[model samples]
Target: MWKIICLLSAVNTAFAGVEKNFVNFGGFVCPREEKALGRCLRDALNTYIPQLATGVAEYGVPPCEPLLIPALSVHQTAGPFAVTSSYTDVTVQGPSTMRVKDVTVDSEQQEIVSKLYIPELKMKGNYKLSGQLLMLPIEGEGHFSGKYGDIDAVVTITLGRAARPSGPDALTCEALDVKFHIGHAALQLDNLFGGDGELGNAMNKFLNENWQKLSDELQAPLEEALREFLKPLADHAFGMLRADDVLGGP
Candidate 1:
């Protein structure tokens, strides 16, 4: 029986897929399913597709921000314990001394800041989501007790289906059963033709190099340095997740 128990545990380790049994976002490390990347992705999908449903089912165009996941669950061992840091009270030289609201952690070039805006993350939304995270073979569960770095964020989107006209198309799209496939995007003939191929060459270069680059007016401008970039990006991303939950977007 002991040998069988050991074998069962080994088989559990071998399981491939997202594990939803995680206690807290902090303890993403210990669970087997949450530890694998593939499983993590599956977990995300399972959480998303269902939330878009509105009695009517649809396969094609799915709604955006369909899942609304809560950040903190009081009963769980896990924590949205967002911050657990060590800081010393010391005077700084920026032409004057002051109490710290933000400071640089010299240990790893990581600067942990207590920002002016910390959104009150509430635990309510039309849709709820919880999923596994893919941290690779890092040999432990996900980060714990904090350090959920900015990218590792919890996000939820809600879209209420007020446009239910009625048929299979509605059901298909509602169910999010629709999928998109990318074929070759045809280049415009007139634009591609040039005296010396200059236009084409330039277009090609732009496509190859600056595909992600956009006009500053089109999107947010890139900040000059690291410190300049951190606050705004973090605020827009994590800080907005739970600011207010009473009213959710459709």
Candidate 2:
């Protein structure tokens, strides 16, 4: 997740019309005196934000799998059950609108900070679980879907010169590091472990009751998953332009 944010920021200056304004990284000489560079970055984001929010970015298993329940112990009126399950073939539906509140640069630190609002994120996948429900054998395979609401995150990105010098103008930047913190995130599970819908609904109720704890447990894995999911897309898009050409600089 951090790397994704860093990579995204590193290419901001590569957006068309902003390359000439050599970012004031440490002590780089910027020829352009105007604020077009800032505008360029914002414009680039505007174009992508809408695309990501409304676009259907497809992903496959091995990379994106259904949410797995590490462990679940529930006491129901019918009975108690402890279970573990795995989901595969995941699909993520991005928000309808991804709003970027602001993008600020700390030249000295080479960091770009941004505030973003995601209206919603929807996901669906298939799952298989083997466990005991009401002390009875519960093994099944079915479909599950979930939606995250009003997510807000703060992303910080640090960029630096590419490790190897290649461009004729020696204008290339790479993502050095990135930090992403989610401020407010709410998730709702429509159906999970829905072998027949009843079990799934019951599980959803259990999850809602222990949402915070579950979130904490899944945070690390979720971050790793997000990073893997976005890396290829970032690389493909960033490869399309060179900083010098985009900036119209020597």
Q: Against the true structure, candidate 2 has what lDDT?
A: 0.47
Model 1 ranges with Cα > 4 A deviation: 1-156, 159-190, 193-196, 215-250
lDDT (10s digit) by residue, model 1, range 10-58: 8887653233322112112222222242243233333332333331122
lDDT of each candidate versus the true structure = 0.22, 0.47
Model 2, 1-250: lDDT tens digits are 9999998887884764464544432223233433444444544555554544334253221322322233232222323545555656656555325566665645455445556666655566565556654464455666656655566655554444332365543333344222344433444344444445786566556655655544433233334434443343334333443434333436
Against the correct fold, how does model 2 do in TM-score?
Answer: 0.51
